[model samples]
Target chain A: MDKRMSIDEVVERIPNGATVAIGGSSISRKPMALVRALARSDRRDLTVIVDVGGPDVDLLLGTGRVAEVIYAFVGFEVLGLAPHFRRARQSQAIRFQEWTEYTVMAGLDAKIKRIPFMPTHATLGTDVLRVNPSFREINDPFGEETLVAVPALKPDVALIHVNYADIQGNGVILGDGHVDVLCAKAAKETFMSCERILSSEELQRFGRDVQILRVYSRGVVEIPWGAHPTGCAPDYRTDLRHLQDYLKAASSEEGWRQYESEFVDVDHPQYLTNHGGPEELVSRLKV
Target chain B: MPLMSEFSVDEVIITTMARQLKGEVLVSSVTAFGSLAAHLAKRLYAPDLAVLSTPESGMDVTPMPTLTLGQFLTDVQQGIPLTMEDIFDAIFTDHFRIWINPSQIDQYGNTNITCIGDWSRPKVALVGARGIPEDTSHLSETFYYILNHSPRSVVQHVDFRSGAGNGESRQHLGPHGAPTTLVTDLGVFDFRGPQGQMTIKSLHPGVSLEEVQERTGFPIGGGEGDILSTPPPTADDIRLIREADPLEVRKLELMSGPMAAEKFVNIYERERQTLHATYPRVGKLGRG
Candidate 1:
């Protein structure tokens, strides 16, 4: 793999109207630099897909780049509702479709297997399966009517964030890995941002299983403080402060741009240090 | 008109009405029927206290008098015998939870959560027993909210029962008890009916026989020809629940009228567009 490119070089690679898939649940382990870059790009008409809903969904939804979002739950749990997704759905501002939690995961699995659609009974009988034509219930080999027919969701590009990677795009997640690994495997193109770039020997110290470099990754960027409030591998604690600010900005379009202008469009990642340290980052991002 | 305590439907109404009766009871208000129940509760019976849980939190929003679950658990560990009143206060004191009903609940009135798919090889998979386990197994009193009635939700046999208040899960629950009542848009229902088959208790005002049939999945058991309209909530119900909590009350108002619900969704969309525009992902490395 090529050595890590400057943040601006990475920013120039991403264009408008891309169907991008983000890894991690909610705000955990999201590619911070990519998110910053996207926010700075000011592109629109984006289609995004995530497993379970979270603030990452909120950020894009709030920014107006997302023309469509597909997921299961959007609300904060039930405090009120996914006020953002709810309001959007109510007004037809963006297209809304929901899949059972399993189907969404399995869809990625299906993509990994290189299948158009995988058959498994997931959301059968419920309104969720019946409403979506893309999903179907087919009989198994035994002629038994079971299995939810789930179409694969192969994203055009996947933005993955992790703990570490080599200059060659080899990476490590150091935890459950969830769907992040699967996202990398399925996406046609992948941009992996890591906390640091490890030498081949340092990566060897972690052992072979720890590394995730393969045909899937195209570029690797060393973003030491990339995850920020979001959790990094080995080190616990997500960037709650930045997440809070993201939530607040995401709650409204005007508020989102103000946030975007400050954190996303910086000339360099070092500006993150001067614009105030971690404390400022957290406080400013908190809604 | 019969008081809410008299019929199955009344029991459902009372669950919400009791909240109003007490001054203010928490209602989930997720679906159309739930919103109606909360609206009625706010109108007729007002509760003294109410709380709301966000989606960020779990869907189960029963509140305890104390702060966190750990605190209550600690109190229990210290030989503090938790009382029915303590549990009821916790559940009754909350705003609402989104619930799903099942076809043919089991002996203890527990609903089905298991699926045809085994852990390994499975035909169909479901979100088995999501909240039913906690809501029925632990909560003092649980509300079984059903939006549409069909053999699916109201049936002779449930494929798998998760939370048992009286029957199988009963052994599991030991003392936590089970559902307090079942509320449907058509009418309130009671699991106390013959063989624990739900029986109709009361009907909402302006509801007709045809409307009830259209909404139900089971054969109507009770509230025969003599059924009467459920009493509408008084003005006090509105002032306390609706006017009192702006965030929750606003949602209640939005659900009050279909047109209003639609309007709320419209405003929600414009905001979504704005968010997406602000955080556009750049080139997005990918094969596509």
Candidate 2:
């Protein structure tokens, strides 16, 4: 069955205060267009789950749409710390639960397998256990070792951006598939935005690169440059100059307001125009 | 009239870090300096070393002059592109060794990349704990490289324990072990003292023991007689570092504020120029 839908329609289906998993690791392959759409919508008080985040988390925090965040790390690698996230945390603006990278994966794994919890040696003695007390310690059934029980992290929805997809909801990631597939499997519903939409036959040629199966996706939107600011590898790189401008604007409240008005509040087409148009973006950001 | 040192502090630290690795499977995180040290080791002594660049799976990646934000994508093309799960599994079960750059590291080798001050309401919020907790708990060996060595960074106790150390509470936690050595701008150190206290292994040339003691927050181990001068980088080692990182990206670790910013801009411009020269067609396409 054809599962294609518009980005706005996908956003409209999401309820307020839902647990949404944002796919991608730091600075790579994030579903930013979907995130921007969610921010532009009237949705509020979201609990975002991300393994590694960059500007996507910060933008939601800056827009005051997020009430809590579950993440392992949220800083921009190399560029510096994320300003809005830092400010929000420092001021007690939002509640956050920190987990190690492994625990986050383990939690998702448990949910995917339909298990109550997963066992791992991670987060045993670290202060992560102290902060996130929900994680329990259980003795090994067969041995003397103790393991941390990572509970299932079942998201209400998962949003991901991919390099290629079909109307049937099958997707292909040309670069490192950084837990995007896991997030899709772990969430109840998954939506994907693709840089290009191909026929099912054409997508089949990718073989193992086609990690996102059709069964995992509820909807797919063909949105070119969907991972802008972040990157969709083999197609374009991160718009570093734009990210620098974002950092500059995010430094102060007034700057952030101006940025939101110029970029965040606009439609995807307007945002594309404001971000130097398709021609400029392709020329500069293309790998 | 000023005296000049034979080697910069970064070069010596890189060399010292390289000396510790023995051609094993090494994992390196985001720090350019630590990555460069791992690359240098692979090229010089540990030719058999397998370097896995994390958060993205780029195994046995070749060296680059400067690392862009999308470096993993570029490196993954040259080598294998494993998923995040594969990388985490390797670190957990394979007993790979790793080097981390933490915001705060205590004497017992406990490190914190999380928030500072209180965990509930932090005085300063840092990047949340990424992989250090699992890396330290499961890896065969964990090492640290610090660009800035001061009382604030080399603290008495980390505000948050993002990585397990040799603290009393961690005895039965089944951690692989505390970090073996920590290389910094001032010197090299090991947790060999009684109760896993940080002991000075060697001081960089021209640095006095008093300077290290003053910079450290706690009373450091290793007596004056026991401490040795850190061996300076050989000519070959310096050449290898320069060749691997021609734009001197490793130097940014030692600098801060406006100086580092200015240097970074210079390096970025040089990197662009080099890229254009090497790939003229792609460069013109990018510009046009």
Candidate 3:
């Protein structure tokens, strides 16, 4: 079965008011192309779960498509606070469900394992338990202690980016998977976009620990420079200059409109061209 | 900007944090200003502190002021990549010391980063439960380096439980101990009592024990009514911080306003570039 789909078709499957878990490290390996496509689409009222939120949350909030954000921390790292996210937060325009890095990790892990909830000692005596009803303290029948139970987060979809993948959906990431692999397993469906799509033989040559098997992938989009602005390790570095510009432009509604028009409104080819072509990105990868 | 006639409040806070790390080798997890205090402590006092500013920043000997992908790649280039996967051993096995800022803390040292009021509907929404939750119950040791020393922050009970402490730690954290030290703008607190409860260790210079009690939401424990003046930052501490942060980026950590968050981001970018050039990459990754 050919599990290959266009970016639009993959994004089209995500309905309005759906919950999505995005896979990436802060300032790295983000599915920028897919995020942009979703922003430009008619989708609305999205609920996002990310460990460290950056432009993914910022853009959706900027476009007024996001209704809530579930996050551990949300910042652009050195690039600064995510402008749209910060404003929305200050204005109380959206609801926020805060989880610790581990809570989100364990929540997704439980979902993947098809468990109702996972037991953890985290957030047991902390202030986090007061607000989130999803996290409950239950007696560890086996361990003789009370622990926090993190309910499974079975997201509707998981939008992920990897360095290399095959049309069949098997993929390889050059760097740390973080909770990306877990997100893929937790979601009902996972759509991947890769920098380069290799054959099954090629994926086998590179081998395990680095590979994400086709079994987890529902569909794969072979889009080069898919994780633009933010980077894919070994493939390219973060487009820092463009990101700085985004930080400034996203601070205001007017500035974000210009950014939204020039960058987000266009399709993949035009988007790559507007970013000074794939060749320019290739040149920026000296590090 | 607290109008320090003789010395600023950070001097005492940073010194206390550095002093805690003295004579110990620790793998620490910190963010923003806490990283600075930990770095300074390692540079001047600890000498065996490994700070994981970011997973990509890995376990660098001397943590850089700004953590960038370039710096991360360089660190990765220097040795095998120390990614999030590596954190398992660091947190559970090797036991990384934790340095964090809690929005709300109770008498037992239980922390809450989730929200301020009721959990269902919060009065104020701050950063969510992150590292403190899991690490609080698992890490070898935990420390709170908070800036706000007010009733709103030092509460009788935290609205949410983000990191476990006190009897809760004994129940949930297992063999990994609970928090031992707390360094705030008001004073240094020690939890090494018969029962693990926060007590005023020493008041900052010019601060009265009464002032601390007046601000704290809970009944002040341990020191009772008589706590000594915390030793002010030595000349070396002040000199090291000044030389390290010429623009005083440390001031941003103290700001309470919304606009300060924006300015902090801008300042961070500008400072990161300049500071990355000078960050001392001391010995190898494993050595620290």
Candidate 4:
């Protein structure tokens, strides 16, 4: 099995119209490098499944790389409004399948369980579940009585970012699991980007069950401090200041190109060294 | 500034609001402004409740509402049908309500929706009053929280009354038949008088009585009741917030830590440093 490959190779694996699952919560444990790679790959008509609901999604939408999105919410980190998601939706540039937080989790759970669908009581009355008939809906036996049902989400691939993993593909969520673990389990294929590849013995010594790793992960890449400007683990905080820059830059074509050239086009490790260089990089880098 | 002992006063006020909300299905966008109050109600009063967001999924910290500019427009164009009153009805048959954030709230708890200058030619643009119309006029009760207790925010006659709970608009909209509570970082105020002019109710922790007086946009009316403090999270409240949802702890930690402690985490500052340090820019051409 190929444990690592150039970003172009990873992009090649994503079919033109594939539905992909992305893991992370806001910036924590996000595959920012991989996302930038995919964006630069010029992949179009793709559907992205995510849990971040923030600028990660906004960047993709703004670049016109995503044809549709299935998400719960898209606000700024702490303030109100994710302006990019809003403007894109307003223009109808992309289609959407909306869900409440619970139902989205339930849908992923259904996929992991290999079930056809999941039953949920969320959005039973409001117009949200009604908006996306593909995944969001009401099971009406009769009358106004309704039961909300979210369709199972079986993505073509799940792209995840984690703190550490072993040669055998056993991954550990360093601090918080976020949604990456769930997305990995729910997809048909799982690709993880990690900081360090531990020896198999060291991973087993930790003792927490690497259930998703052995069971679901198809490939893993060792990209030290992969989620930079975002959190890694046991080290620094998200470069929220940098993230804000991404949001502003990604809003325009010129800005995005500048972002792409500087960050995305590099070996994963080089990307890190280049962005912050070695020492300041060494200080904050988790791996 | 009220001492720590005064904490119970805020709790009582919050509990008073909670008591009235029992049995109602509640709904609200996730915002720090109303999140604590909403979280309190969700944990204590509305457990079986569900949260909805405009972003379909894959959006925010949790899959909760991630506010975007367009969605803000949607929320404004078509007010989230899940009205505060509707949420109240779910909490209880009679009515349910929430204490929301207002940009510029006034003595009558009348919130400003339009621009500060003339409605047509406003100097500074504020988020137009999105749901205040329904929240103040239709809900059985309305509550307002002003985080920054400043003179500009708590004014005499708001340039434009976005949601009406005060004298003139109250007469125009008639009554939705509910009392209003106005809480500020400085102090607590409540609607009194026939026209719903806000009367000083309580002061918050670390706020001076004189400060509250000086910051008012307009003169406050009624008895200067003993000002009070807000309740710290109860053990049970903390437990549910931390465990019932793991994200709460993580989210709070992130929000409270060093990255967040910046006086201002501006891209400009970051850009200057990133450039000065001579590091490679990841996405585009800029510094931060």
Candidate 5:
């Protein structure tokens, strides 16, 4: 009856080569604990669906757990490129499907709506038609105009981190959650890591719009500071210094290994201790 | 004294980009280095301009420098925000113009941010077509900024079509306009030449017409037609820019070779303001 599990336990359920989508925008509020767990594990050949992804994609790509990346863009926000992802792409070690925000959203909407495909004008005049075969161009039935029909994206699993969740797996998203809701709705299996494990009644204190409900989520875990370094807005700010350090470390193999060892090699409990645990983050929360 | 003298390449490009935003568009959005130019335009010339400051920043009343994701969060914390849906809808509405940076631009005005080789696969992988599809094909006006211009970037045919220009595949595509201006380190280019291929509207101060053609992957401005050149930025423009981008973080993205000894003073003074008080000295430089 209880859906709560440890970070490692939830990640263990994801098989190698699974197509997974991680929530949050670019560098903001990523599911870093779950991501770190996946990286630490022996999972291989993952295809990550991401928009505005930073370390979520870069860390997995660096660890060689990724086979492909589906992204609108993946860079270090403004600190330049995602070093590990860029290195892998330059060597052709990775495969990617370049998409716009609309194409990816449309793809997810198809699965959420249980439709075969979603038609959009996003790729009508662009080279996305040629670059990605995942979408097909067909003439509109009512008119002569060309419309692109993007295939549905039903990832094998979704790894999302939210600010709050109940033991039964309802989640509370705090800020500008770009496509996380659609991602959860579209994903076949959804695993979440949250800052707090609240009661179903406590979740009601939030207005109806924030919660992602138990039906869409498969499992949830309570891991304080779970999305550290990456901002969990309405909670702690993005640890800029930590992100900068990671950026520097990721630029080289030796540095990345050191960073991975320092952060990812440990369990969620141990990792939380290194980052001043839950108390420090509690005071920083905007709410 | 000449109003247009003793300005750096960075200032010229900034002014050129700022002027491009001068027309009647109520809102302007720019990505990467283009945002700094947009910021300057709002302060200096286009006081009425509303900027979608960062990539995530939609219509904000104030122009805060959100050069990073962290700053973007700050904007959201303090400002009235736009949802991802609203931002995308605005692209189709045609009220605002977008200024984007392209990895490769073809003669017909098509741009590519997809992989540099065969679609099946090969060569360098660039940042995929994020907004190029919507911005290039749907927005009212779209301009481009190329930091490093060379034969590889200005090509005959892009390896994969990320943004549609005036190519054969886009002939029937309507409601999509070609880019208004293609500003680069070398010069400002447009698609006014025969058959809508790129041609030189104006060459930069130090650059030559022959050099531009030689470096271009496709032919431009020669048999196509006579090329025109515009005057460089005035001293007043330089002062405005120096005050605007006090941090001179943009210099890293645009400055080539060296500016004279005096240009160093502006860069140092502005950078110091951030290094000392705004942020820890080490944190402020690349942080912006």
Candidate 6:
């Protein structure tokens, strides 16, 4: 079965008000091309889930597409706090559900195991419990210990970017698979965007790096330099200059609109051209 | 003896943090200052220490002295790559120890990186609690490195508890332990005070105990005669720190405002120069 599709098709499958889990941590390996496409699309009321978000979460929120965000941390690492996310949260422009990195994983673990909830001692003594009242405290059935019950967070769609993928939906991540596998397992459907599409035989050469099997994916789209601005590991590094530009533009409403019109509203090829070109991006971003 | 004027306060904090590690498995985030301490400790004190870099999910990473951006990418390429799930599981083990950097810490050592004021509508929304809760709760000995130690940072009470500390609130929270020590610009503190309050362990050279108390929001333990002077970094320690971070990226945490911005630009320029010098053909890709 050829499970390949265009970026537009993947975005079309995700309806408005859908719960979407984005793969990547902070400023590495984020599916930015697909995220940009989603931003260009008229999708609205998205409840986005991420462990450590970077520009992807900020872009969605900046475009007013996201209604809520369920996340552990969302910042630009050393670059400073995410301007759009900070603005949205401070002004009460969007609702947010906060969880620690462990609880976020535990919630996904519950979904993967097909359980109602997973018990953990993560947020017991913290005020994170007060903000998120849905997470209940209960005694272990088998033991006498109190634990926070993290409910299963089942996303309707999971968007992941990888280094390589075959037409059969097998994906390979050259770098750390930061919760991307868990997102694929827990989501109802998973779509992958890859920098390159290889043959089944070529995919096998990656050995253990082929962490995403065909069974876990619904569709795979070939989008070279897909994780640009962020990174695709041994292939390229983050375009910090571009991120600094993004930070400056995202600081204000007018600047954000100007940025969207130039970067987010355009097609992927044009977007590549705007960043110089494929050659420039590959040479510059390539590790 | 390295003179007090020879090293910055950041170097003192880094050496102090490095001294606390005993060749244990150390998990570190992408923060520049904390990661430097971990590297320094591994290099000088704890050669056998396993440094697990999080978010990137690299194990035993001996990273370049560049900031988090350069270091994390280098870590992914050089270190053994593991999945985030693998890292999450490793945190619960007995060998797991981590060093964290939080925005705010209270008298009882509870940390808050979530918000500044109210939870419903925060005055300033900092980054949400990342892994502090889980790391502090599970690890037997967790360490902290606060770059700036003002009343705002060391508060009387945290607005939100991102990491469980040695406070009254943590009594019923299973078998979790409080933070072992907090390495700050002023000095070193531990939770060995009365009722597990943050007590002064050592005052940095030239930093009086009165100054530390005045800067702290709550009353600190270890008054006057009890306070010990933080040992200055030896000449060998200074040489190793400078060798590990030639561009002086550790100084970024110690600076704020326009000073930090100027320093960041300078560091990036130096990094780009080093990159271009090494790979001449890789110069055409616009200023990164």
Q: Give the best candidate by DockQ.
A: 2
For each of the candidates, give the backbone clash count.
86, 0, 14, 41, 2, 0
- Better structure of 1 and 6 per DockQ: 6
**Per-residue lDDT for A1-287 in model 6, tens only?**
89999999999999999999999888888999999999989999999999889899999998889999999999987677898888888899989999888788888889999999998888878888879856998988998888889999999999999988999999987666788988999999999999889899888877888889899899999998898788776567677668878988987778988999999999999999998898987666554
Q: Residue B211's C-alpha lDDT in candidate 4?
A: 77
Model 4 spans > 4 angstroms off:
A1-6, A79-83, A135-145, A209-211, A251-253, A266-270, A284-287, B1-262, B266-288
lDDT of 5 at A42: 94
Candidate 1, A1-287: lDDT as tens digits = 57577666665666677777778644346676677667556678877877645556655665567887766544332122333554455456777555644466667778889888876533433434434557876668777455557899878788888877888787876533536766787778788888778787676665633546657887788876676545453333344334445556666768867776776557445546745765665443321
Q: Which runs of model 1 end up more than 4 angstroms from their true locations?
A: A75-83, A208-211, A250-254, A267-271, A278-287, B1-288
Lowest summed lDDT across 10 adjacent residues in model 4 chain A is found at A121-130
**DockQ by candidate, in order:** 0.04, 0.54, 0.35, 0.03, 0.33, 0.50
**Candidate 6 error regions (>4 Å):** B53-56, B69-78, B257-266, B269-288
Ten contiguous residues minimizing lDDT sum, candidate 3 chain A: A202-211
> What is candidate 5's fraction of native contacts?
0.41
Ranking by DockQ: 2, 6, 3, 5, 1, 4
Compared with the true structure, what per-residue lDDT tens digits does model 2 show for residues A1-287?
A: 99999988999879999999999877888999999999878899999999988889998998888999999999877677888899999998889999878888888999999999998877766788889856888889999987888899989999999988999999998777888998999999999999989999888887888999999999999999899888787677666667777888998889988999998999888999997799988767554
lDDT of 4: 0.56
Give model 6's TM-score versus the native structure.
0.94
| lDDT tens digits, residue span A1-287, model 3 | 57899999988899999999999866778888899999999899899999867778778888888998888876676555566766666667888777778788888988888888988776665656655657888898986888788998879999999978888888887655657888888888899999877777666665653457778889999888888788676566667667777877876778888999999999999998987887876765323
Q: Write the per-residue lDDT of candidate 2 for residues B1-288, one digit (tens) a residue.
A: 112266677888888888788745745556677677778888887887777554455677674534454343343345666777677777777546666889999989989999899998999999998888887777767889887899999999999988888866366565475678999889999988778778999888888888999999999989557678887888888898888777878777767755665666667666656655653332111332
Predicted candidate 1 versus true structure: per-residue lDDT over B192-220, tens digit per residue: 65545566666676577677665555566
Tell me what fraction of the real C-alpha contacts between chains A and B each candidate also makes: 0.00, 0.59, 0.46, 0.01, 0.41, 0.60
Interface RMSDs of the predictions, in order, are: 15.2, 3.0, 5.2, 13.6, 6.6, 3.3
Judged by DockQ cut-offs, is candidate 5 incorrect, acceptable, medium or high? Answer: acceptable
Segments of candidate 2 deviating more than 4 angstroms: B1-4, B53-55, B69-77, B258-266, B269-288
Candidate with the larger lDDT of 5 and 6? 6
